[model samples]
Target: MQSTKLVETRGLTKRYPGVLALNGVDFDLEAGEVHVLFGENGAGKSTLISMLAGANSPTEGTITLNGQALAFSSVADAQRAGIYTVFQEFSLIPTLTVAENIFLGWEPMRGPFVDHRAMRRRAHDMFEELDFPIDPTAITASLSRAQQQMVEITKAFHGDLSVLILDEPTASLTDREVDHLFGFIASLKERGVGIIYISHRIQEFQRIADRVTVLRDGARIGTVAMAETDEHALVEMMTGRAITEIYPQIAHTPGDVLATAEGLVTSGVSAASLEIRAGEVLGIAGLVGSGKSRLFRAMMGLAPRLGGKVTLKGQDVTRAPTRAILKAGMYYLSPDRKAEGLDLAKTSNDNLALNLVMGGTGVSRMGFINWKEVRAESARIADYVELHAGYRPKLVSQLSGGNQQKVLFGKCFGQEADIYVFDEPTVGVDMGTRSALYRLIQQLAEAGKAVVVISSDLPEVLNLSHRMLVLAHGRISAELSGDEMVEELVLKHFFDESGAKA
Candidate 1:
């Protein structure tokens, strides 16, 4: 007999005025198994799951639950049918408390009034069960991105779920939080719930996934058992090409120091010191709350530096404003792209033009912008970052995560800056996009520009950095170069207590 199928889709298709987002895709999930949808951004993974979660309706084909046809009119309808989805873009209201958002629609009621006490108690129990530390009374907006992610997961757990679809669930989670999430998924599997997982991290597939489905350009390429496939094969299936090296090796020819910080101190960072040189990649790595990003933010004047001396090309910029620092030939790319990098409501070309105008790159004259020159320059920068020409006229929010990241990366080329700092540059990007970004970093260094990369991804920093600094508890724990940047040694430094004391 055939194994139990929890959910199935046949000939699924979605189309818009000028695009076919998903095309005739067939997929299924078995009970108690993790079925991962693996693909590059814009490969129709999100479109397919959106349909499954009732966020969108398909133009063609049918969906079935337990061999019976079903149609959901809204996300609530899907939830009532025992299907819950944690989308990549959060759905929680920022102004509400965690408990309020968790039980927004289906609140516990007593007689004619909502029983808020019961709701908070239930939410607290769910968090305790999942081993997640979050206050039910806390305002949702005050939580970090990772904590908000846990809130989303906790909200889903409040429902009676037969199908749980998680879209890039661990994108903002730390290693310990990831472990808790994986354990929770294992428990869900034991309860015979079907899971549809979507993520760009290839290394995570082997840990929880039992089956894999690859999509490319809105069509399903193939499906295979996870046990039978390797990373190389999955990448080739997703990109339709071989990526021999995900990280490029470049010549590290260090020159004069372009930027330096001595005794850097911020609200999150303690006494940290480092140097960024021309023609080399400097990497900073640490765990969550380790102050890896804060150090650079303080040096760039984005954060309040309590005590520090920062210099750019021998000029003291310790108290310079952010605008002055940028005008002085230094650019910093924030890790939280949605909040700090791009304007979601604007077109990709418009965002790139904004950078050029800020850098005084002749895209504007006096008080008026030169639209023709801006478009031409934006197109050139788009090509350099491998952003599709078709996406230039569309809003940045309309693009996929990888393409949006490309737009942000392309902004760097629009300005004439000697120092480029990228924080968590490849957070939610696919392997192909990561490879492209890595090449761009390599090109920048070869052109004699100073490059600094701060990331929580240990492997990425290890492979890309010419010199690596490990941050622990807001201080530099260890600095390694050449043969000293191995995984074992770097991981040990991540928890070095000696670095914690000022």
Candidate 2:
């Protein structure tokens, strides 16, 4: 391990038209050290890193490398300087193979031809070094999100890297995959590479961070050695207040059954049976590939169902398309907010007005469109969801992660459906927004709307749901209510032998 500063930022500031994304913040990363950049959503973490990575130019700041001032004109410039960042949203081309994507733009060439064999060999070597199992010839689009994330990381570290930035790298990973990622990071740290790790999961810091820096509302609170600070203290520093309990117990009174699945079989699940009751929240907990998401999609006919029966309010709605399912007053909230939940390139009104248009409420006469009326309804729902900056005309991409998620909720809330299905609703949401989302779910239940929340977050599912279901290997293994909904027991059923049994 080296005892030298690899990178430093002094008075770093980035400003948008109306928002000061990052203030004059000073930070540093030491060689061979894992420095965790801790902050809530919109706290300027992304802006700061983007500037450092040359994805965005700093409005006012100074970046130094080995005591020399560094001015990166573009991401390529940063890459030449051995600085790399793996952002949450991947940048891989869906049509390219994993090996091709890894060496994209800088592929080895023999005379006038690209050296495909050499590229595949190098990709295979990189995967072997990390003990990562991924087909080099597999198309990027065909890979799962977690596998795509691996491709991104492999691309970032393909050659030489003095500084590595990882933002929410584990959000898409399963527990075992996370272990592998951490082990690989450990090796990088031992090799004297400076790493800037960003994650909303507080529990992860203690495991990999050597030092932690807290940023709040664009200003740096302070940096503390990992051994000197605890997770509770770190949370307080990041939020500027103690998050007493993020998960609050809500007394939900479940009413008559609103939806039910009997002897259900889908592309990834089988023999599943459950009921969703109005005025209640049903929580589903499982590992990443355990078929929870598949079950929801199959219910809506988004996935192929081998055999199953799904009924909404005593009406058997089997083998129905997604449109029919939505027409039946049931809505699905996508776990991947950016990819499937909301269209980032479109205007806020356009995205927020999707459900209204889909439900035929955006039209006036003879299939004629009334964008004005749709905008009016959009404004109403945006206000109800407390949209960022109050329905301003901007692409959904301009909003922060939390606000983008809010816009997704707005788009879905416009449905006014009898039942709502949420998958990882709060996956990338920060503490404050997560609490607000919990309240929103509770409000839905109180208003007699049935909700099903499927999350990898155990405590969140336990606190938010009135009745909980655990799935393993595509089958419902345990149903726990009230006293049986503790985290430990739910986890046992989630990973235990019983969860995989039919």
Candidate 3:
């Protein structure tokens, strides 16, 4: 029996003014199958999908739907042809309600006036069918990121869906939310809907994907069955190098305690206590909303601390402002880099220099700016973070996810902070970038700096940290070191409600 080809692209190529975004890429999707697009950032995955979704026209290519050659001029044209794409960056209007955002352009109307009752009912029915718990009447802005993502996914169910493209759909979702999404995908597959799934999370491919296509430097590397290939092979193909070690081995030599949080309390955190010592990487692991990030955020004054005592080098700074804490030599790297870390409108060089200027470092003197010094120092920092010199002058928004993370990492070196806290530092980045960042963290710890890493990735925390803390129910459930940091033991403590030590 022959399966239908829902969509196909032959010799697809996209070219910009001076760069070839995608080159001679051949891809296809079959009905009732999940085809994954796996590659590093800037590997032509976005460009290929954009052309298929009619967001951009390829310089040269041929697209065929169900054996009929067609060219889509706009996103609406593709949508009309039963092709829907859920982009990574949300297109929802914050001011509008969930139902309104779902059916923005095509609204149910009662004689030119939108029928609010019918729209809400249809939205409710759609969510009920998908088993997604989201209030259709809730304002899009008021909902959590995970709920907003569900709204976006629900929008695809508005009309006849033949091809569904999901771009990093589970990036903001929790474990339970991800399970629900996977179940939904299973239903779609059973209905003979071809799905194109794009994600940097390789572990998910085995669960959801039937076939995986690897792209590199705007070229198609190869396509293989998901069951036949392993993570190491895929990583090597995407990075053109056999990575012997993803997490760098660092010497754990703990010195005097550099920072301590005694009885830290916040809206998300109950009572938590921890210490950051010099020349050690202290890893914090927990599920989403388990107070892993909240503990440090409250101590740094980013969030309100209901009650806590934060001391730096034996000096109390519990009531100090965030700026004061930063000035006192503590650098905190936010997980949400786009919103809280970097200015999208500013150039990478400018962002790094901004930190130096604020810290009154060599980039500025006596309330005056030094443009030449800023460029030199920013370039040095960029190189240190392995960011190419060509990207320094470009806006941070124009760079890929990995490069943008590199720019943010470079900003940390602007000021000589003794204590460094990284929250989900390698969230959306690729394997190669993760290796580079891990090496940089190792270097920092080896230099006698107090390093604290808070991550949702279990393997990341277990492999990198000399001492690992597991948080559960808004409190520290267990603190493990050496052999105690195994995956089984950590998983056991992740759900501990009594906050008892393992």
Candidate 4:
């Protein structure tokens, strides 16, 4: 493949307070190829891309395009220079139509007013060209993650994009949607569009990467052709260790049922029933909108149960509110760390002690709480989860995605809940952090704490769960235990059990 250099970075460096996000590193991208960037969370993968996409100005180094040095002051500057970035979190407005979101602030105008018809027509054309069926007039909030992703990608293509940067593009997409996205990317590559892809899922590299670059501790570890390196070698490069087994699910006998849901129904779920037992992980597997999350939320009374009962610790909590359910020694941890899980604006110590500080009996007669106790308790949980102590004082917003998640785990560790419900616990975390979280989960089960892990990653559920429950269209399609828990069988229920219903 003979291609000219489209973008290049020389001795790139980024410094933030005590952190060195990116070291003096040299990187380059050529036209018509997919170059994957791999690293653990906080490994500078995003930092490097932020520089390339002009989201951040580098404290040091130079950027070049077409053999000429270039500097970008803002995202608009990057877009004008033919660079666009699609972030993991969306930028679409919930109430606006798809076309409205596509154009955003720059609507197609006729003299002094906006031309809604022309904008919708253009959006429809872009969707057709990508072989996707996203309705331009559909509400942006009503579209599925895959459809929204199409809108985001189209927004980039709407511009004269010479280079595209996608961060965790397939994180929320189903397998079918993933195939569609891959094909779309292939077409972009054929058009001489240089794509910079970043993902924690190593399996994705095998599908789309031409060349893979590994970053460790803000420095380039190595760059290798995708055809030449295996997943093992890639993991070894990203983490300075040879991880023989990523999932070390220790075998243990499950104890008595700690929590039970009987005919539970929620907004997304029609009817679901299951039991969570001590010393075992009850795995929940389903596609997006399949009600796996709703089932858990309903179980904890987070969502109103229209009918049926949830017996937690032999006590009926069907009518009990979420606060009471948690008081009953059951806790629900949201997979979304930023919104529902932790306060990104607060210090890690505050986020860690959020629950205890409010719920505990440490308030003084003058209404002054015990600060030392909170700090000690927070530190202990952080140490157990392997989070850096230096990060305890930093705002959660400053920590990496993986560390912020650790803070969530730390909160649960302090509470010592009897039944722990984790939804997509390892979504964007790196391979090393994943292994650590896996161990922490196994340890919890071994300690006789009941666990339920709801995840889109089938491999994660199959490995950690003693029993698996596959949901489809708000119903339990199949329940597998012992030797019946395989990926093929579990996924079959995700489709066959759900059928084509809502």
Candidate 5:
């Protein structure tokens, strides 16, 4: 049987000020095949898919589907051409029911009335096809992370899409949910739908993908048959590095207990307890809603707390406000940068200076703002992180993903906090920038600062953490150190009942 090309892009080029996100790159997908897209964050994978999905236009490129050139002036245009894309961030309407979200704008009508029954039935049918256990009538706001993703997939399935793009679909999914998704992809392939799967978990490529395309620095490195490659080779191609060493070695030892939490309780988890010492990197690993975020938020004083003792350097700060915690020389970098970390509409200098002003530094108390100090700080950190950009005062929204992340890190570094809480600091970031971040973190620990990293990436936690805690159902289930850092050993915590399961 001959393969049919479903989607193809040629000479794709996209430029944003100082960064060329995609430069003269080509990518092609075939019908009935799972095409795995691999890149080390900021390699233009998202940019290319956004162009194909009609979310954004390329500066230069030709996108053809089924041998016909297509121009997506809007997302509707792409949808009309049988293309669907599910971003890493869920785009479903939270207030709507699952059925309503699935058939949002293209509802089947029964003689001038919205056919609610028909839509629900169709939505249920879509779930049946994927064998996903999701209630069609459930409000999207009440669903779990994996359940919400199933709705997103069902929407695309019902759309009868010829090309389906899934970005990091398994990032928030449980092990069982991941298995279900892999099985669902096989069913999609049997139905002759061309699927593009993007994920950081290189292990999945072997199981689900037929061919793999690697992108690096906004260019196509190479494409190879999945049958002919291994994970090490794939890593080498995507990053252009041997990757013999995946994690950075922990150098600093744990010193005085910098922070401690006891009896922390939230809607997500209960009886949370943790401790971190100065110069130590402590890691919290768990599935979403397993209480990691809630614990961090409680410690930072963002969420409502119920019976908890939070101490910083043995000082009882259980009732401290978020500002008080920050004032006491502790800083938190949230996982969601666009929503919590940066003011996207503001200039880079303004974003960096807000930290200083919030802490009531000398620059604020002088009754006269010094623009040079702000500019100098931003410039110095920007240069240290190697963000090669013009000092033209650009909005953070105008910067690339890696540069935006650098700015976010810069804000926290300027605070000179004694204890740093980093929530997925390297999320959606490239490998080069990630390496730089690792070095920056190590240097911080070397300077006698305690760092707590809450991440879902197992390799990252094992690589940087001197001590690590695994949370299951909102409670600390396992603590691993030294020889217990291997992937299989750490993953056991994720699945184990009491560190006894495989």
Candidate 6:
């Protein structure tokens, strides 16, 4: 491992018309070191990385590489300069084979002829080097999110990447997959690759990062050695407050059955059905690709309902589309908040007012969007959710994860839905924001709304759920309620051999 500075940025600043996206930030990446960039959403981490990737040019400041100043005109230029970035969104084409995507532009050529065999061999070798078993000939669409991520990383590192940028690489990965990714990163570091790692999971940072840098509201807080600071102290510097409690439990009396499904079946599952009671939080837990998400989508009509009878408030409603199901007082929040919930390209006001405008409130007049009415209702929901800066007209991508979730909740709060289905609502948020979300969910139940929180986080499910269901291999393996809230019981019931048969 070399002790040379591979990349450095000084006085980096980027400003929009109304918001300063990145303040005069100073950052450096040493050769062969894994440096984690820690911050909340909209903490300017993405902007900084975007600039580094040559996706966006910095409004001010200078970037130096290996004691020489560098200017990249585009992402291609950045890659040519030996810097590669893997964003949260997989860059692989879903319809293309993994090998085709890996050698997309730089395929090996033999005497002016494309060498397909060489391409596949190199791609397979990359996977083998990383100890990943993904098939290079398989279509990218057939691969799971984790597999797709591996493909993306392989593509990024196929060539010489002196500095690699990974944004939330493990957010969608399972524990095993995360371990694999970390192991690959360690290998890359040993080979003298500097990595700029970004993640919301603070616990993992201490495990992998040699040094840590904190940014808040577009300004650099400070950079420190990982061994010198703890996650709590780092969070305090990032958010300016000590977060003691992440999840706060609230009590509520259960009410009547708000929703029920009979013989529900979708393409993703066989015979499946469930019921949700008013003021009840049903926690659903499962591994990735375990059909837990499918069940939620089927209930909300996001998936094709093969066979089912859904009833809301005693009204028989079956085989309805997403719009109809939502109209019938049911709503669903996606785990992918940025891609599915918020419109990163649009302003916060528009994203928060999406349901209101679509539902034809005063915001919609004769199929026309009334900007004034939309803005007014958005302001109300933003206040209710206590969003910072009271309805930021800025883009939704420019907000923190906790704050973005607040906007998502604000959008849904405007709709009068009797049942709310939340899928991984706290996936990438911090402890404080997660606690606030739990409080909000409790408030929703107290207001007589039946809530189904689908999450993989065991502690989150145990703390917030009144009743819990475990889905194993597209089937409800276990159901526990009332006094049966022990984590050990849930695990054994969900994974034990007899539990599978039972």
- Backbone clashes, candidate 3: 0
The sequence of per-residue lDDT tens digits that candidate 5 reaches over residues 25-55 is 8889999999988887678888889998899
Tens digits of per-residue lDDT, candidate 6, 1-502, equal 4479999999999999989999999999999999999887778999999999999999999999898998889988898889999998777788989999999988899999989899999998988887888898999999988898888878776557899999988888877788888988899899999999998888688779999999988899999999998977887888787755555565657898878877777775656667798888889877665677898788778787788687878877776678887888889999888778888888777787777877776743456677788778878778777787644788887766778888888778767798999999888886557767888898888787888999877778888888988877677777788788888888775553322322
Q: What would the TM-scores of all predictions be?
A: 0.92, 0.91, 0.96, 0.88, 0.86, 0.80
Residue-wise C-alpha lDDT for candidate 2, range 1-502, written one tens digit per residue: 4479999999999889998989999999999899999888889899899988988888898999888999999988898888999898788999999999999998989889999999999899989976778999999999977789888878877568899999999988888888888988999998888999998887788899999998999999999999888977987887666756655566677798988888789877878888999988999998888888999888888888788699988988886788888988899999888878888888788887777887777686789878888888988878877775554488889877788878888887776699999989988778777876777787788888999999887767877888888998888889999899997888778765454335
| Model 1, span 1-502: residue lDDT tens | 6779999999999999989989999999999999999998889999999888988899999999888898889988888778899988899999999999999987999999999999999999998887889999999999987789888877777567899999999998878878878988998899999999999888899999999999999999999999999988999999877756778988899999988998889997888888899999999999877888888888889999899799999999999998888888999999888989999999999999998877666644567777778778888899999998889999999988889999999998887899999999999998888899999999999999999999877878988999998998788999899999999999999999788335
The Cα local distance difference test for each model comes to 0.90, 0.85, 0.90, 0.86, 0.82, 0.83
Better of 4 and 6 by TM-score: 4
> How do these models rank on TM-score, best leading?
3, 1, 2, 4, 5, 6
lDDT value, residue 364 of candidate 2: 68
Off by over 4 Å in 5: 9-21, 54-64, 67-74, 89-100, 131-148, 157-160, 172-176, 244-247, 263-273, 362-367, 499-502
| Deviation of model 6 at 326, angstroms | 2.7
Number of backbone collisions per candidate: 0, 0, 0, 0, 0, 1
Clashing pairs in 3: none
- Tell me how candidate 2 scores on lDDT: 0.85
Worst 10 residues of 6 by lDDT: 493-502
> How far does residue 52 in candidate 6 sit from its true spot (Å)?
3.2
Superposed by TM-score, candidate 3 places the C-alpha of residue 438 at a distance from the truth, in angstroms, of 1.5
Tell me the lDDT of model 2 at 19. 89
Q: Cα lDDT of model 5 overall?
A: 0.82
